[model samples]
Target: MSQVPMITLNNGVQIPQVGFGTFKVDAAVTQQAVENALEAGYRHIDTAAVYGNEEGVGAALRAVNLPRDEVFVTTKLRNGEQGRDLVQRAFEESLGKLGLDRVDLYLIHWPAPALGTYTEAWAELESIHRQGGARAIGVSNFLPHHLETLVEGAEVTPAVNQIELHPSFQQPATQAASREHGLAVEAYAPIGQAKDLDLETVTGIAREHDVTPAQVILRWHLQQGTVVIPKSVTPERIVANIDLFGFELDEEQVAAITALDSEERMFPHPDEGNFTMLD
Candidate 1:
């Protein structure tokens, strides 16, 4: 059912490279937004406990009534829920909210290096994988050093590293580290929070391809082998986000977009802000 390309994780779990993201999607509208996404042919849905909308994602899954195997659902453990024991409990809570027996992918939303508990939490994630509670386990917002530390201390190498990535703020070092460690780089804010949509390089390419700048940016991500999860509640935008399989970007077009990387991250760095989950 998915015409979108699938990126096989290190563990052999195939994830749709272009998934629907629900970062700030309000809980009240998350279900409908997710429904719009599913109806528009999105087979992957990324959410988190901090987002407070797993229930909506779950509802959309049930409403869409696609074969469970056909959809790859990813949710993260909240920053507040990072203890060895707490992570397990958090995973259960997320599963309950999503109404799933097992998730396709479960990630620690942040490394939370200040807490000094990520390694312990990773241990529990490994145990969960062993027990079939999660098909894959990963970390989000981790930088290169954090990735090095986590991989050094943990048994299960993360299957994916979800991070802030867009044309203007691509973290090349982090991407290199993730690839070096065998983790798939999953890009959140794939469209640069609308900041990169109007850049001359992106727009020029978009005009050449007869697509939106958002589409151009997304196409750039896909061509470079990163998984992109772009969020949108608007029905037209939702449909347009996943409409990426029809065209291919040639070498020069891809390079021009790649040249836009400024290392300017649009979101909080892994070690910078409050480690606590959002309200």
Candidate 2:
């Protein structure tokens, strides 16, 4: 097993810098996919209620028999499920589905400002944290303004901000805002969904390191102190995604990849619609 590096969040919870993502993974295969990832030395598994695979993730955990603390599990509230009346119930449903008493991290999947209940959702998350139901609470797909609004009434600071960050679409402003509030930045599409693998800069760096472009890109994120969850159902790819610690990217190579940022966000703007990151 590769010695994956850990990022200590503001609340003192440590998460693997490299994690196996289950965003688009099918429920029918989600169990086996998570099983294969666990066998491949992945200690972190990211799934959401919207992903509809928390049961499969739990099944895989039962099958693997690894200690609960060995794996870091994260889930999110559905886009339409954010409010004082609904948020707590939704979180309990996620926990019941995952077969766990608590989750390592729970996030409000979206701000859905139009719904105007994210601050209320944060209150419930804070309550969950106080009750020891969620080790950490955070938000996803939140912009700077959303963060500002959330913190105004939040008694607890979010530990993380999961966003659609990738090599091709680095939202530097959002990252700056998240850091300003002491939240750890997490990247969902860290590889740009493989659209960045064929880039000249990425390929050159991959060739220099004798690794795949995916590994190089993930390593770049790691070197920059960002948590990345690259998803794959294929066993080989799952294994390859976490095998990143063996090699490292130097400053020049990391810079070349960072220069590829074009603000070309592949996902919808956070404020535009109630996107659940379903794609």
Question: Which stretches of model 2 miss by more than 4 angstroms?
Answer: 275-279
Q: How accurate locally, in lDDT, is each candidate?
A: 0.89, 0.91
Question: What are the clashing pairs of model 2?
Answer: none
| Model number with the top lDDT | 2
lDDT, candidate 2, residue 8? 98
TM agreement with the true structure for every prediction: 0.97, 0.97
Across 181-261, the per-residue lDDT of candidate 2 in tens digits comes to 999999998998889999999999899999999999999998888999999998889989988888989989988998998
| Cα distance off (Å), candidate 1, residue 20 | 0.2
Displacement of the residue 85 alpha carbon in candidate 1, Å: 2.4
**Candidate 1, which ten residues in sequence have the lowest lDDT sum?**
270-279
lDDT (Cα) of model 1: 0.89
lDDT of 2: 0.91
